[model samples]
Target: MTSNPPLPVRPTRTAQPGFPWQHFSMRFSSTPRGARLARRLAGERLDAWGIPYGSDAHHTLTLIVAELSANAVSHGRVPGRDFRLCLSAEGTTLRVEVTDTRGEKVPTLVEPSDALDGDGGRGLLLVAALTDRWGWYPCADGPGKTVWAVLEVGTT
Candidate 1:
Protein backbone atom coordinates (compact mmCIF):
# COMPACT_ATOMS: atom_id res chain seq x y z
CA MET A 1 0.00 0.00 0.00
CA THR A 2 1.14 3.53 -0.73
CA SER A 3 1.32 6.19 1.96
CA ASN A 4 -0.68 9.35 1.41
CA PRO A 5 1.26 12.41 0.36
CA PRO A 6 1.64 15.30 2.76
CA LEU A 7 -0.81 18.14 2.19
CA PRO A 8 0.46 21.68 1.81
CA VAL A 9 -1.80 23.07 4.54
CA ARG A 10 -2.92 20.15 6.72
CA PRO A 11 -2.20 20.90 10.36
CA THR A 12 -0.13 18.50 12.41
CA ARG A 13 -2.47 16.34 14.46
CA THR A 14 -0.40 16.91 17.60
CA ALA A 15 0.44 20.54 17.07
CA GLN A 16 -0.39 23.19 19.66
CA PRO A 17 -4.04 24.15 20.01
CA GLY A 18 -5.36 27.59 18.89
CA PHE A 19 -3.01 27.62 15.94
CA PRO A 20 -4.65 26.38 12.78
CA TRP A 21 -2.86 25.06 9.72
CA GLN A 22 -5.88 25.14 7.43
CA HIS A 23 -8.46 27.92 7.26
CA PHE A 24 -11.51 28.81 5.16
CA SER A 25 -13.58 31.98 5.44
CA MET A 26 -16.54 33.40 3.58
CA ARG A 27 -19.52 35.69 3.98
CA PHE A 28 -23.02 34.58 3.08
CA SER A 29 -26.39 36.33 2.85
CA SER A 30 -28.22 36.21 6.16
CA THR A 31 -30.96 33.96 4.84
CA PRO A 32 -31.95 30.35 5.36
CA ARG A 33 -30.41 29.54 2.02
CA GLY A 34 -27.16 31.14 3.07
CA ALA A 35 -27.12 29.15 6.29
CA ARG A 36 -27.59 25.96 4.31
CA LEU A 37 -24.74 26.89 2.01
CA ALA A 38 -22.45 27.61 4.93
CA ARG A 39 -23.11 24.15 6.34
CA ARG A 40 -22.44 22.44 3.02
CA LEU A 41 -19.27 24.35 2.27
CA ALA A 42 -17.94 23.76 5.76
CA GLY A 43 -18.45 20.01 5.35
CA GLU A 44 -16.75 20.08 1.97
CA ARG A 45 -13.81 22.02 3.39
CA LEU A 46 -13.36 19.49 6.20
CA ASP A 47 -13.42 16.66 3.68
CA ALA A 48 -10.77 18.35 1.58
CA TRP A 49 -8.60 18.63 4.67
CA GLY A 50 -8.64 14.80 4.95
CA ILE A 51 -11.51 14.37 7.39
CA PRO A 52 -13.72 12.79 4.68
CA TYR A 53 -17.45 13.38 4.38
CA GLY A 54 -18.92 10.49 6.41
CA SER A 55 -16.57 10.38 9.42
CA ASP A 56 -17.80 11.12 12.92
CA ALA A 57 -15.70 14.28 13.09
CA HIS A 58 -17.02 15.54 9.79
CA HIS A 59 -20.63 14.95 10.81
CA THR A 60 -20.14 16.68 14.14
CA LEU A 61 -18.36 19.77 12.85
CA THR A 62 -20.93 20.11 10.10
CA LEU A 63 -23.82 19.93 12.56
CA ILE A 64 -22.31 22.65 14.72
CA VAL A 65 -21.88 24.86 11.67
CA ALA A 66 -25.48 24.27 10.63
CA GLU A 67 -26.84 25.27 14.01
CA LEU A 68 -24.66 28.33 14.35
CA SER A 69 -25.37 29.48 10.82
CA ALA A 70 -29.07 29.00 11.31
CA ASN A 71 -29.01 31.08 14.46
CA ALA A 72 -27.08 33.85 12.73
CA VAL A 73 -29.64 34.04 9.97
CA SER A 74 -32.60 33.78 12.29
CA HIS A 75 -31.91 35.92 15.37
CA GLY A 76 -28.84 37.89 14.32
CA ARG A 77 -29.87 39.09 10.90
CA VAL A 78 -29.58 42.81 10.12
CA PRO A 79 -31.74 43.45 7.10
CA GLY A 80 -29.28 43.86 4.20
CA ARG A 81 -26.24 42.78 6.18
CA ASP A 82 -24.77 39.33 5.61
CA PHE A 83 -23.28 36.85 8.00
CA ARG A 84 -19.77 35.46 7.90
CA LEU A 85 -18.59 31.88 8.40
CA CYS A 86 -15.06 30.95 9.27
CA LEU A 87 -13.62 27.44 9.72
CA SER A 88 -10.22 26.44 10.94
CA ALA A 89 -8.44 23.29 12.03
CA GLU A 90 -5.88 23.46 14.82
CA GLY A 91 -4.29 20.22 15.95
CA THR A 92 -7.15 17.80 16.66
CA THR A 93 -9.69 20.57 17.18
CA LEU A 94 -11.97 22.18 14.65
CA ARG A 95 -13.28 25.69 15.32
CA VAL A 96 -16.26 27.36 13.69
CA GLU A 97 -17.14 31.05 13.90
CA VAL A 98 -20.35 32.66 12.61
CA THR A 99 -20.61 36.42 12.71
CA ASP A 100 -23.79 38.44 12.25
CA THR A 101 -24.65 42.11 12.67
CA ARG A 102 -27.02 41.99 15.64
CA GLY A 103 -24.87 42.10 18.74
CA GLU A 104 -27.77 43.22 20.94
CA LYS A 105 -29.51 39.86 20.70
CA VAL A 106 -26.91 37.55 22.15
CA PRO A 107 -27.60 33.90 22.78
CA THR A 108 -27.73 32.47 26.29
CA LEU A 109 -27.73 28.84 27.27
CA VAL A 110 -29.62 29.53 30.47
CA GLU A 111 -32.73 30.50 28.49
CA PRO A 112 -31.88 29.77 24.82
CA SER A 113 -34.30 31.29 22.24
CA ASP A 114 -37.86 32.62 22.54
CA ALA A 115 -40.24 30.73 24.80
CA LEU A 116 -38.74 27.82 26.74
CA ASP A 117 -42.04 25.96 26.28
CA GLY A 118 -42.02 26.49 22.53
CA ASP A 119 -40.18 24.37 19.98
CA GLY A 120 -37.89 27.16 18.71
CA GLY A 121 -35.32 27.81 21.46
CA ARG A 122 -33.12 24.71 21.41
CA GLY A 123 -30.55 25.57 18.77
CA LEU A 124 -27.89 26.82 21.12
CA LEU A 125 -28.79 24.12 23.60
CA LEU A 126 -28.10 21.47 20.99
CA VAL A 127 -24.84 23.23 20.15
CA ALA A 128 -23.78 23.24 23.79
CA ALA A 129 -24.48 19.56 24.18
CA LEU A 130 -22.76 18.51 20.98
CA THR A 131 -19.59 20.55 21.05
CA ASP A 132 -16.78 20.62 23.58
CA ARG A 133 -17.36 24.33 24.17
CA TRP A 134 -19.33 27.19 22.61
CA GLY A 135 -19.89 30.91 23.22
CA TRP A 136 -20.55 34.31 21.67
CA TYR A 137 -19.21 37.86 21.87
CA PRO A 138 -19.44 41.20 20.09
CA CYS A 139 -17.46 41.33 16.88
CA ALA A 140 -14.17 43.19 16.99
CA ASP A 141 -14.61 44.55 13.48
CA GLY A 142 -17.78 46.58 13.33
CA PRO A 143 -21.31 45.87 14.51
CA GLY A 144 -22.83 42.43 15.30
CA LYS A 145 -21.56 39.41 17.27
CA THR A 146 -19.63 36.27 16.60
CA VAL A 147 -21.00 32.93 17.78
CA TRP A 148 -18.39 30.23 17.92
CA ALA A 149 -18.05 26.52 18.75
CA VAL A 150 -15.13 24.14 19.06
CA LEU A 151 -15.21 20.35 18.87
CA GLU A 152 -12.41 17.92 19.63
CA VAL A 153 -12.06 15.79 16.53
CA GLY A 154 -10.44 12.39 16.68
CA THR A 155 -10.43 9.06 14.92
CA THR A 156 -13.25 6.76 15.93
Candidate 2:
Protein backbone atom coordinates (compact mmCIF):
# COMPACT_ATOMS: atom_id res chain seq x y z
CA MET A 1 0.00 0.00 0.00
CA THR A 2 1.39 3.38 -1.00
CA SER A 3 1.49 5.90 1.80
CA ASN A 4 -0.49 9.05 1.04
CA PRO A 5 0.98 12.49 1.69
CA PRO A 6 -0.20 14.23 4.84
CA LEU A 7 -3.57 15.94 4.36
CA PRO A 8 -3.46 19.72 4.12
CA VAL A 9 -4.52 21.37 7.35
CA ARG A 10 -7.00 24.22 7.27
CA PRO A 11 -6.40 27.16 9.58
CA THR A 12 -9.21 28.16 11.92
CA ARG A 13 -10.08 31.82 12.25
CA THR A 14 -12.71 33.64 14.24
CA ALA A 15 -15.46 34.49 11.78
CA GLN A 16 -16.24 38.17 11.67
CA PRO A 17 -19.89 39.01 11.42
CA GLY A 18 -21.58 41.60 9.23
CA PHE A 19 -20.52 43.34 6.02
CA PRO A 20 -17.57 41.95 4.14
CA TRP A 21 -15.52 43.74 1.55
CA GLN A 22 -15.45 41.84 -1.73
CA HIS A 23 -12.72 42.52 -4.30
CA PHE A 24 -12.68 41.91 -8.04
CA SER A 25 -9.86 42.70 -10.45
CA MET A 26 -9.47 42.28 -14.19
CA ARG A 27 -7.17 43.28 -17.05
CA PHE A 28 -8.14 44.21 -20.57
CA SER A 29 -6.50 45.42 -23.73
CA SER A 30 -6.25 49.16 -24.04
CA THR A 31 -8.90 49.55 -26.68
CA PRO A 32 -12.44 50.78 -27.15
CA ARG A 33 -13.93 47.31 -26.92
CA GLY A 34 -11.94 46.63 -23.77
CA ALA A 35 -13.28 49.79 -22.16
CA ARG A 36 -16.86 48.78 -22.92
CA LEU A 37 -16.21 45.32 -21.54
CA ALA A 38 -14.88 46.78 -18.31
CA ARG A 39 -18.05 48.71 -17.74
CA ARG A 40 -20.37 45.79 -18.47
CA LEU A 41 -18.36 43.43 -16.29
CA ALA A 42 -18.49 45.86 -13.38
CA GLY A 43 -22.28 45.95 -13.43
CA GLU A 44 -22.47 42.19 -13.65
CA ARG A 45 -20.06 41.74 -10.78
CA LEU A 46 -21.93 44.24 -8.62
CA ASP A 47 -25.17 42.36 -9.28
CA ALA A 48 -23.50 39.10 -8.30
CA TRP A 49 -22.37 40.75 -5.06
CA GLY A 50 -25.98 41.42 -4.04
CA ILE A 51 -26.00 45.21 -4.53
CA PRO A 52 -29.43 44.82 -6.23
CA TYR A 53 -30.10 45.30 -9.94
CA GLY A 54 -30.92 48.80 -11.18
CA SER A 55 -30.10 50.33 -7.81
CA ASP A 56 -28.64 53.84 -7.57
CA ALA A 57 -25.34 52.43 -6.43
CA HIS A 58 -25.21 50.01 -9.33
CA HIS A 59 -25.85 52.61 -12.03
CA THR A 60 -23.49 55.21 -10.56
CA LEU A 61 -20.67 52.73 -10.18
CA THR A 62 -21.21 51.46 -13.70
CA LEU A 63 -21.02 54.93 -15.18
CA ILE A 64 -17.88 55.71 -13.24
CA VAL A 65 -16.17 52.61 -14.64
CA ALA A 66 -17.26 53.50 -18.16
CA GLU A 67 -15.71 56.94 -18.01
CA LEU A 68 -12.48 55.87 -16.36
CA SER A 69 -12.02 52.95 -18.69
CA ALA A 70 -12.61 55.19 -21.68
CA ASN A 71 -9.97 57.61 -20.46
CA ALA A 72 -7.53 54.80 -19.87
CA VAL A 73 -7.97 53.46 -23.36
CA SER A 74 -7.93 56.80 -25.11
CA HIS A 75 -5.38 58.83 -23.15
CA GLY A 76 -3.32 56.34 -21.18
CA ARG A 77 -2.77 53.54 -23.66
CA VAL A 78 0.78 52.31 -23.98
CA PRO A 79 2.19 50.31 -26.91
CA GLY A 80 1.56 46.81 -25.60
CA ARG A 81 0.48 47.16 -22.02
CA ASP A 82 -3.09 46.53 -20.89
CA PHE A 83 -5.31 48.42 -18.49
CA ARG A 84 -6.69 47.08 -15.22
CA LEU A 85 -10.02 47.61 -13.47
CA CYS A 86 -10.60 46.89 -9.79
CA LEU A 87 -13.84 47.15 -7.86
CA SER A 88 -14.32 46.70 -4.17
CA ALA A 89 -17.25 47.20 -1.88
CA GLU A 90 -16.57 48.04 1.73
CA GLY A 91 -19.49 48.59 4.03
CA THR A 92 -21.96 50.90 2.30
CA THR A 93 -19.30 52.45 0.06
CA LEU A 94 -18.18 51.08 -3.28
CA ARG A 95 -14.78 51.99 -4.68
CA VAL A 96 -13.81 51.78 -8.35
CA GLU A 97 -10.25 51.99 -9.61
CA VAL A 98 -8.93 51.95 -13.17
CA THR A 99 -5.20 51.74 -13.84
CA ASP A 100 -3.29 52.21 -17.07
CA THR A 101 0.32 51.67 -18.05
CA ARG A 102 0.97 55.27 -19.03
CA GLY A 103 2.21 57.39 -16.16
CA GLU A 104 2.89 60.57 -18.16
CA LYS A 105 -0.76 60.96 -19.08
CA VAL A 106 -3.20 62.17 -16.44
CA PRO A 107 -6.90 63.05 -16.60
CA THR A 108 -8.58 66.20 -15.35
CA LEU A 109 -12.12 67.16 -14.40
CA VAL A 110 -13.79 70.15 -16.00
CA GLU A 111 -17.16 71.80 -16.34
CA PRO A 112 -19.78 69.98 -18.34
CA SER A 113 -19.74 70.89 -21.99
CA ASP A 114 -22.36 73.31 -23.15
CA ALA A 115 -21.34 72.96 -26.78
CA LEU A 116 -23.50 71.09 -29.25
CA ASP A 117 -20.29 70.01 -31.00
CA GLY A 118 -19.54 66.31 -31.09
CA ASP A 119 -16.33 64.67 -29.82
CA GLY A 120 -15.72 66.88 -26.84
CA GLY A 121 -13.80 66.26 -23.63
CA ARG A 122 -16.34 65.53 -20.88
CA GLY A 123 -15.59 62.06 -19.54
CA LEU A 124 -13.85 62.91 -16.29
CA LEU A 125 -16.20 65.80 -15.74
CA LEU A 126 -19.11 63.41 -15.65
CA VAL A 127 -17.19 61.08 -13.34
CA ALA A 128 -16.52 63.93 -10.89
CA ALA A 129 -20.14 64.91 -10.85
CA LEU A 130 -21.46 61.41 -10.27
CA THR A 131 -18.99 60.00 -7.78
CA ASP A 132 -19.01 61.17 -4.16
CA ARG A 133 -15.21 61.57 -4.35
CA TRP A 134 -12.67 60.74 -7.03
CA GLY A 135 -8.90 61.10 -7.43
CA TRP A 136 -5.82 59.63 -9.01
CA TYR A 137 -2.67 58.25 -7.40
CA PRO A 138 0.67 57.05 -8.66
CA CYS A 139 1.01 53.30 -8.83
CA ALA A 140 3.10 51.87 -5.98
CA ASP A 141 4.90 49.59 -8.41
CA GLY A 142 5.81 52.59 -10.57
CA PRO A 143 5.42 53.35 -14.30
CA GLY A 144 1.62 53.64 -14.06
CA LYS A 145 -1.20 55.30 -12.17
CA THR A 146 -4.59 54.46 -10.73
CA VAL A 147 -7.68 56.68 -10.95
CA TRP A 148 -10.15 55.88 -8.21
CA ALA A 149 -13.64 56.95 -7.26
CA VAL A 150 -15.90 56.22 -4.31
CA LEU A 151 -19.67 56.39 -3.91
CA GLU A 152 -22.17 55.60 -1.18
CA VAL A 153 -24.19 52.51 -2.07
CA GLY A 154 -27.54 53.81 -0.94
CA THR A 155 -26.91 57.42 0.06
CA THR A 156 -26.82 59.99 -2.69
lDDT of every predicted structure (CA atoms)? 0.85, 0.82
RMSD of 2: 6.7
How many clashes does each candidate structure show, in the order listed?
A: 0, 0
Q: Which digits, one per residue and each the tens of the lDDT, describe model 1 over residues 1-156?
A: 899997787555332234348899999999999999999999888877777777777787898999999999989999999999999887777889999999899998756535478868788888898898988889888999999998877633
Q: What is the TM-score of each candidate against the true structure?
A: 0.82, 0.81
Q: lDDT (0-100) at residue 11 of candidate 2? A: 40
Q: Any runs in candidate 1 off by more than 4 Å, and if so which?
A: 1-20, 111-116
Clashing pairs in 2: none
Clashing residue pairs, candidate 1? none
The worst-scoring run of ten residues by lDDT in candidate 1 lies at 11-20
Q: Report the CA-based lDDT of candidate 2 relative to the real structure.
A: 0.82
What is candidate 2's CA lDDT for residue 84? 98
